[model samples]
Target: MHQRNISTRLKRRRAGDPMREFDALPPELRRWLAEASLPWSPRSARRIWRQGLKTGGVDEALRRLESAEVATLKRDRLAQL
Candidate 1:
């Protein structure tokens, strides 16, 4: 519950500003966000920034992290099979 409140406050405070959100997150999450964004070209990254204006950028980043984790798990499982 306490952690949830902290996350909520962080989201409310940062809103659409992904850089601020990146700064506020713990090191691991910040690293993940950076890695996920790294594949895009500058123009594509700018488009992401504009899109994030409507959807909370941090939320999108977290989703990206989740996606990467799921993909890794799937790959590992397939290798075992």
Candidate 2:
């Protein structure tokens, strides 16, 4: 079994994207990502992180916004159908 540091795990999850890319993030960003109930793979956390960054640094906030947008789009399209 390969033991890896949490950061390495996180990096892999981000598809090996350099952490320097997210240097603008606060220290809490890593802790928040670690605590989030995402799938065990680093890839899942990376996806959340990417989305969170896109939505301005709050993972849950970004998820909610994305979910709302998706739901709204689905509803609109269904209505058009």
Instruction: Give one clash count per candidate, in the order shown.
Output: 0, 2
| Model 2 segments more than 4 A misplaced | 1-57
- Highest TM-score, which number? 1
Candidate 1 runs further than 4 Å off: 1-56
Worst 10 residues of 2 by lDDT: 2-11
lDDT per residue as tens, model 1, 47-69 = 44445435766667456545554
Candidates in order: C-alpha RMSD to true structure: 13.0, 11.5
Q: Total backbone clashes of model 1? A: 0
Residue-by-residue lDDT tens digits, candidate 2, 1-81: 322222212212334445553454455555544443332343444465566677676756457534643464455557667
